[model samples]
Each structure stands twice: as C-alpha cells, then as structure tokens.
Target: MGEKFPEIQGGGSLILAWQVRNKKVLVIGGGEVAAGRILNLLNADAKVVLISPRDGLNSEVAHRIERKQVEYYDRKFEPSDLDDPAITMVLTAIDEPDASTQIWKLCKEKRIAANIADVPPECDFYFGSVHRDGPLQIMVSTNGNGPKMANIVRRRIAANLPPNIGDAIAKVGALRRKLRVVAPGTEEGPKRMQWMSKVCLKWSLEDLCEMEEQDMDELLQSYAPDQIPSLSQVRLGEEPGTWQFDGSFGWACVV
Candidate 1:
C-alpha cells in the first residue's frame, strides 16, 4: 500500500493579546451592551470616547458619563466621527440596524478595527469571556460561533483552576527580580533562568503562594555554595516534600 499524508484541518482566527494601553477607542452607542464594552476598554486603560443620543443612555452608561470616566458627545454617531486618525478600535451597540452597518462600513473604509454587538459576521474582532485573577487571565472564545457557550466554558474552567495561581506567579516574579539583581550581568542570564526554572518546578504552587517577603530575604541570604537550597534547609525543621534538588542544570552529564 502507498503512504498517504494526513488530512488537513481548517484554520481558525489568530487569538492575540492586543495591548490597547494609552490608545483611543470610539464607542458608538449608549445602551447596556455599549456600557459593557466601555468597562472592558477602561479596564485596558484605553482612551474611550462615546457617541450616542442623550435619551438613549442606559443607567450604567449615564453613571460613567456623570463620573467623567469617559469623553462622550450627547448625539448620534456621524461620518465625521471617524475623522480622528487616532481612533484604534470602534464598537457599536445600538438597535438601529442601518446605523450599525453604516458604522462598520465606515470603519472598514478607514481601516479601523470594529465590533458590532450581536453581528459577528460584521465584526472585525470579538470580545471573549475573560476570567481574571490579579496578573493571571484566562480567555475563552468560540470564534464567533457561540457567546453564551463561551461564558459557560469559561466559568467551568475558572471553577477548576487553583484558587491563587496568580499569587504563585507574583511570587515567582518577585524572586526573579531579586535574583536578577543579586546575580546581574550578561553572563548570569543562563544561570538565572536555569535556577528559576528549578525553583518553579520544585516549589509546589501552595508553597510558592505561601512565601512572604521575609522568606524571600532569607532565601536570598542563603544563596551560598552554587545558590541552591532545599525548602527544609531554608525553613529549618519543615518538610522538604518529594522534590529532589541536585543543584545542577543544563547539559553535559557524564554517567
């Protein structure tokens, strides 16, 4: 029999962690959907400007306007709204079908990315269900196929995750910074990474999260003899668990 290649699967959208910090985004509605978009944008530290009629404003959107959280005009969206070259993204969430389509068209003409709520086909991108804990974030997307289902999946994933994985990450970051300074210079980069990798693997998630600032200080101070120490050595009488620490990393091991 002749050999054959496996069948190919179709491609999906390229999910990205786009940074919109300090950039301007235009939102062309004042309804609840637009309010949610505004919250998400503000969370990203984007400069948001909203356009909607004064009467169309939902309570949440109006509260934002009252607090001056965003710059908005009390009027409907117009063609001139896209005149600003600084606008990076546009979102519309109004009941007017013709107006929403017009906004999407104008955005396409201006080469500005857009998302029209409930109209996935017209959207340049989409909002995913995000579960965030401090510096850790998990996003669930259905590629515009299902929104509610995405939320359900996200909720389930969030429920199953460790309670404070974010804290563990923060602890790692703290150690990395102190370790870098203690062992600085270009030659120390490899040593630094190898040592940190061992630290991440050997120290369980709960143990890392339990580490405090003083523990870090003592850990740094105990960095004698190749700068590797067991948890029991550092803690004095505490159990070291099952992790074996050889204090050696990288290649070239002779048997």
Candidate 2:
C-alpha cells in the first residue's frame, strides 16, 4: 500500500526584493492611487512612463511631469504602449476595470510582470508597507489581504526596533568586509561562516549598536589563524549562560 501523507495547506507567495533600477515601467492613470504607485516606482529607481490624459493627473504627478522626473505622455493607455520591449513591467491604477484587465492580459502576452491596482487576482505582485532607514528597508506583506494591517505591523516593528539599528548594520558590514580581507578567499569559508554565526548569537543588539572601530579590531583578534576564541575570551567579561536571543526582533539580549 502507498504511504499516506498529511494534507498540505494553501500555498504562499514568494517574497523578494526586485531590482528594477533604471528599468522602464509603464504606468497607467494619474489619480491618488497612481500617484502613490509612481512615487514607489521612482524610489526603486525605475524609469516611469506615465500614460493618462493631462487632466487625469493629480497635483503631485503633474508636478513630477513638469519637473521631468517621470516620462509623461498625456494620453490614454494603448496596447501599443506594451510594444516598447523596454517596458518590463506595467501597473494600472485607473478606475476602469476593463482597461486594467486588458493591460494585465497584454502584459501576460508579452511575458512582462504586472500589478493591477485593487485587483488581487490579476496582479503579478503586491506592494507592501515598508519601513525605511539609511540603507535599511523592512517590508511587511499581507499578500494582498490587508494593506492597512501591513502598515500597522510595520509601524509597530519600527517603533520597537533598538535605536541606531541601521547604524549597527552599517558598522557590522564594515567588519564583515575587513574580515573578508583578513581571511581572504574560500579557504576560510566554513570558519568564517561559523565565526559570523557565533558573533550574532553572542552579541546583543545594543552591544552591536555601540560597536566602535577599536571594538571591531579586538573582535577580529579572536579570529586569528588556527584559533576560534571561546565566549569567555571574546565576549569580554559577559558569561555565555546569561545570553539569550529574542525571536520577536531576532536580536540577542542579556537575561
């Protein structure tokens, strides 16, 4: 007899950060929703080509056009617009459902990614509420279920994050680069990964946030050739038994 397996639950969307910098994306409509979409695209460095009658544009989008920030065509979306093989994506925010659907179908035919505003079933992607700091972006997605809920969760997370968290990331990134130079190449790959994991598990977020150039120099000393220092030596005077990791923010704490 064939072995039985437990029933599988529903599927999930694969969340990812797309690289759209300098890529041409077609935008339809110029209302409030489209205005928001345009700004999001611009933030990603996407070259936006907006198609809507001049009067359809909101004050913000209109100003953007005048400032030459967006490539504008004061006309309705035409199927021919998709012909610009350079337009790798299209987003529609017009009130016309039929028009939006047609745009989606055209994108499908052309094998281009598309996001049809307010129409989940037809969208190739959904925008999430994003929390941003210098070189840091955290996106919360509800998979088109509840955008407002995503925003609430994002806000809560932003409020709870330790101060100077982004600064910590930047400093750690510099340490990582230094380590790569010191260790150099795949010869130290396994040891390097192990050391990095230990660092995260042992160092509290506040400790990392407070990391200085001198602290980093001392930390690297622990990774000297043929030696991986124990917590007692590398963690200063802190005991390993008192360290804990809080999963809520995925940071270390001293309990």
Clash count of each predicted structure:
0, 0
**20-50: candidate 1 lDDT, tens digit per residue:** 9999999989989999999989888899999
The residue ranges of model 1 lying beyond 4 angstroms of the native Cα positions read 1-8, 180-191, 217-232, 235-255
Candidate 2: C-alpha RMSD to true structure equals 5.5
Residue 108 CA error for candidate 1 (Å)? 1.4
lDDT, candidate 2, 155-188, per-residue tens: 9999998768787677767778878988998989
Q: Candidate 1 at 97: error in angstroms?
A: 1.8
lDDT of 2 at 153: 99
- Top TM-score: which candidate number? 1
The CA lDDT of each predicted structure is 0.81, 0.80
CA shift of 190, model 1, Å:
4.9
Residue-level error in angstroms, candidate 2, position 250: 11
RMSD (Å) per prediction: 5.9, 5.5
Error of 2 at 50 (Å): 2.1
Q: What TM-score against the true fold does each predicted structure earn?
A: 0.81, 0.77
